[model samples]
Target: MTTARRKPYGVKGAPYAFLLPATVLFSSFFALPIGYAVWLSFHKVHVFGLGLGKGARSEVWAGVENYTDALTDSELLDGALRVLGYGCIVVPVMLGLALLFALMLDAEKVRLAPFTRLAIFLPYAVPGVVAALLWGFLYLPDVSPFSFVLEKLGLPQPDLLDGGPLYLALSNIAVWGGTGFNMIVIYTSLRAVPAEVYEAAKLDGATPLQIALRIKIPMVASSLVLTFFFSIIATLQVFNEPTTLKPLTNSVSTTWSPLMKVYRDAFGTGDIHQAAAEAVIIALATLVLSFGFLRAANRRDKQEAAG
Candidate 1:
């Protein structure tokens, strides 16, 4: 047998040369910072004497002290629970509305589909902070149109910015901002499906709902999975919306979410070591939740294929 030929040096080097800038950027910007955070997580600053000079403050091994503290902190646990509740409301409602709108757009003989689609997606073009600010004004009692409508109808206008209502208020902002983007994604996937599939289903006398349930949804499962993955990640890292709302309302704390808690530790408290530990834990938790859902989806797909 002839020996396998090797790629020429110049040919082999071309790809690496092309990738050099990205590699350098990734290492400098991404990999190195992650490595540094990991290092910081396992270290603590020890004060010597009055802690006045360079040698006065020394870095020592922490041995998971920060991690243990974070894990056992009731404030962190409460914040996590709050986020879980917020996510429960946001994810389903957002994705459900997205899928519904996408199906409606994909339906034949739909009215003003282009205008409606653009209007639904317009919120996506607004910055998250701006969107939150606008919504915060809408939720305010004095300036809210909803409050005005309720007053006209002789109904009590419930405070949307406090207590349990606060959860719904925040969830609404997230859903409104996110649903349009997800709708566009799902709608794009629906458009990719072959027209022949719909033609055959129609010939077989399947109703629009039946086609949506049996064919359209199944065909767009990959897009749903993709959107779900990103939604979960975004929900976990919720910061901007809540941060924007904090100035408008007293209900939101500095440590409203795990990420906020990390920020509080890092800057507010000047404890980088603890902040790094919390950040790492949050990162690991996100990875675990994401991959766990992906694996479950994969297994379901395999089972469906086997059946």
Candidate 2:
């Protein structure tokens, strides 16, 4: 104790000093907005007689009334159902294509691997709104080359922007834009697997498909899970594609997605309190579903390990 030396003040405070900017930025941008939203969720406007004067309206505490209304709202529920249906198509198809492309890229004797990977991934760099707009044009019967070809061939040209096909159209845009990123993630994971493992598999007379199924896939299971997790969250929060396509299609309503509904409630109807409440609900639902999936995945992993 007598021989102990004191640390310099700068060294002792260095970690906090380094973190100060991030802490300030997080508090200012993220934390403050979230706190304000939560605060707004629990408050509503109270209007006096005629609702005309400057002092006529005031903010008042609203308990759980906003949350109750949001839960009971048919529009919100329908939007949730629509998003769920969209997710069902998007998640599996996107992940499947990603895995397929990643495996193909990782295979031996593959030609132009870098070019192929870049071609597949380039769509992801495009903004979602631009992607939607581009696809929206393709979906239009008059402007679409597919429709023109079908007409020339004397075949039926299906309406892609309306009814059942609308879901497929939206799902395609998501899959196209998302597959590349997931493929890269999975491919990176694959590249990290030991070469000796592949050599041993080859020595055991395993074919390429067998090796991929047994060794490669199992080794990349965590990557798959991670992609799946992100896919689920993105699916639930879908807004841009639908919103961008909305102008071109009569089928996409103002309340097409939960987020769209939130936007409509906040700006369209000028009800920030209601919008905040709905936003909070959507955030809570996303959190619950994400964590629930993670928990199930963890439990399965633990069981597999024990087995």
Candidate 3:
């Protein structure tokens, strides 16, 4: 009986025991915060007319009031649209640059690959705020080499801090900061592709372009999917870049992204309940979008595998 009872606690269970600390931390930090956020999202405070005494305020069930408010908020919706526009530029440009750098690095005759790779990726080590600050300085007319050059050539100086140009400025920061990581992801996957695959394509009289497009890219689809997923999530949570840029420009508001709006609402405006509700909605939307993209990617992968 003792031996039989002890079987469950053998090597198999030992790993779980080792993981107990991590599980506890997850429950305490991640799980609890998420649960509390959801709970708080559904409640609001009601204050009496006098609004004087402590007991004058009471928590009341708000049901979907906050959710509806968040959804209907023009500021948040505009922020969402702004982020979407920024993402349109950031996602493609960043990933394209990443893919280009990866391909260049993977090439047999590329020069300075190591130096370029490190230089490009070094921005990732810099905090987002610091990166924004650094880039912000570089964008300033007094400090920018580009502006100096344009001035020398007597060309019209473009305003980068306002209107549509601001999107480009913000997108550039994200692209510069993110490209190296995505490049590494793509490059690692590229490295993992067997030499035999390339040799086989070569033997088949396939040109390098044909080999890259037909075989190399298709093989690294999984990595691309992963990068795309993470990039989209990061795009949705864009906060630091705009916030940092705010000191230098008046275009950026307190609510520059949906997440930023939620933050502003919760802390800035003292509306945690509304912020919580907005947060839940954003989380749900993100999950739905992510899962949908993942499912589509999986389907495409299966089809490619079958073919």
Local distance difference test scores for all models: 0.94, 0.97, 0.90
Query: What's the lDDT for candidate 1?
Result: 0.94
Pairs of residues at least 3 apart in sequence or in different chains that clash in candidate 1? none
lDDT of 3 by residue, 1-307 (tens): 3554455437788889899999999999999999999999999999998878779989999998888988999999999999999999999999888888887788778888889889988988889999999889888888888899999999988879888899999999999899999999999999999999899889999988888788888888888889999999999889999999888888999998988899899899999999999899889988998999999999987887899
lDDT by residue (142-207, candidate 2, tens digit) is 999999999999999999999999999999999999999999999999999999999999999999
**Candidate with the greatest TM-score versus the true structure:** 2
Model 2, residue pairs in steric clash: none
Weakest 10 consecutive residues of candidate 3 by summed lDDT: 1-10
Q: What ranking emerges by TM-score with the best candidate at the front?
A: 2, 1, 3
Query: Candidate 1 — which residues are off by over 4 angstroms?
Result: 1-9
After superposition, the stretches of candidate 2 with alpha carbons farther than 4 Å from their true spots are 1-9
Q: What is the TM-score of each candidate against the true structure?
A: 0.94, 0.97, 0.93
Q: What overall lDDT, based on C-alpha atoms, would model 2 receive against the true structure?
A: 0.97
CA displacement after TM-score superposition, residue 244 of candidate 3 (Å) = 0.7
